[model samples]
Target: MKHGRNLPKLGRKAAHRDAMLSNMAASLILHHRIVTTKQKARALAPFVDRLIQTAKNGKKSLSARRLVARQLYSPEAVEKLFSDTAPKMSDREGGYVRIYRLGRRVGDGAETAVVTIGMATIKVDKKEKKEAKKHKGERPAGYDRTKDEEIFLEKAAAKSKTAEESAEEAKAS
Candidate 1:
């Protein structure tokens, strides 16, 4: 008998769910992308999209800002949404947020996902990528086994010498 129930409860009551969604929406608006659970990402996608739609429809009007402000947790997020995100999305229609499934969590085994603004581009530095590929399967830089062993031996010898000196002092006394 699950009929006409559009919104997911997300394991929280009405007020708590709204607060969590508001915080999550604010974070998503401030930072272009966020990593979260798959279910949360799914819930966040539509929530953020509606805010973007509101901003887009209102065209940065005072009422629109106030309306969006009511749903978002941060005023800065509201400003960014109205000034930056909304304008960028003006050319397009809905679907402002995009969710990408990122495997499962290691600890709790919950499914993970990456929620990102649809227009944002995630960039990886070419030099860093090249270095990573170049050093794949190789020891990290400045890792010298001989040097490490020497340092360990030196420390152990120092400890032994201290112990011997303390023993000699005890015997002399």
Candidate 2:
């Protein structure tokens, strides 16, 4: 009898668990990342993946939106799921989410984890690293170090020249 009932109860009744999972899934959809207990994160990852899969399948279909809406219950989250999140994951088959364990909590000692959409990290080349070191301050807003190194350096040099000119003008004044 207990053979197939292997899902974690999470110390909650069926309705409570469903509601919690729905809310958590909606939050994850809207925010793209969340922090929670390890067990909960594990439980949520599959749920979110399924939702993303549904969104990917449906795309702009009404039935798919309705199906996802039933589980998420948030119109904004549903829109984000269908419009933004799903399209980004269109090429991927599965495993849309990732979980990172964060060791134990300080107060209760419960293990924590970060659940997030699988975002790709940009690799920094040796030349870029050397260029980044040459300019030793925070990059300007909208400047992507990985993609626009030369543009960033050009802007930095322009800014430095402007700053020096302003200083010289001030001294002359």
Candidate 3:
């Protein structure tokens, strides 16, 4: 009976649906996360992720951001879509958006999902170690820790001598 109506109208007029999608896309870009109906989130993720991928290489191009803005309706959202989030997403070839199921909405019991920007965690040991060391304290120019750990050499020498003298007296020789 309900033929040729595959797309979910989302109970909105055509213009309103377009506007809603545009705003949702922009918010998703700028905030890197957004909440919406499960169906809408599923429809939006791949489309928005592809757009972010496109935005990555288009940072300097005014036309590119404008085009995205036209589709998205917000100038600032477009700016950040091009500048901040896109570059981070550039490294990944695809799959730049994630959808998490958040159960049902209270009003009408409609299903909801959270859409988020995808990021991979890099666990390179050396880089993490370097960052950790930098956070612990300020180091001088040309800093050398292996060399400075030897600053305890004087204390070690004193302890050794005390141990040696005490051992000699115990030996009674």
Q: Once superposed on the true structure, which residue ranges of model 2 sit more than 4 Å away at CA? A: 1-5, 120-173
Candidate 1, superposed: residue stretches over 4 Å from native = 1-5, 124-173
81 in model 3: Cα distance from truth in Å?
Answer: 1.0
What lDDT tens digits, residue by residue, belong to model 1 across residues 24-140? 999988989999999989888888988999999999489988889899979999989988999999888888888888999999999999899988867689999999999898987
Is candidate 2 or 3 superior in TM-score? Answer: 2
What TM-score does prediction 1 earn? 0.69
* Backbone Cα, N, C clashes tallied per candidate: 0, 0, 0
Q: What is the lDDT of residue 132 in candidate 2?
A: 85
Alpha-carbon RMSD of each model: 7.7, 13.9, 14.4
| Candidate 3 residue pairs in backbone clash | none
Query: Deviation in angstroms for 56 in model 2?
Result: 0.5
- Give Cα-based local distance difference scores for all models: 0.90, 0.88, 0.79
Task: Name the better of 1 and 2 by TM-score.
Answer: 1
TM-score of every prediction relative to native: 0.69, 0.68, 0.61
Q: Which predicted model would earn the best TM-score?
A: 1
Candidate 3 residue-wise lDDT, 37-130, digit = tens: 9999877876687677668767779777766766877888877777778877766788888888999999999999988878632237998899
Report lDDT (Cα) of residue 31, candidate 2. Answer: 84
lDDT-sorted candidate list, best first: 1, 2, 3
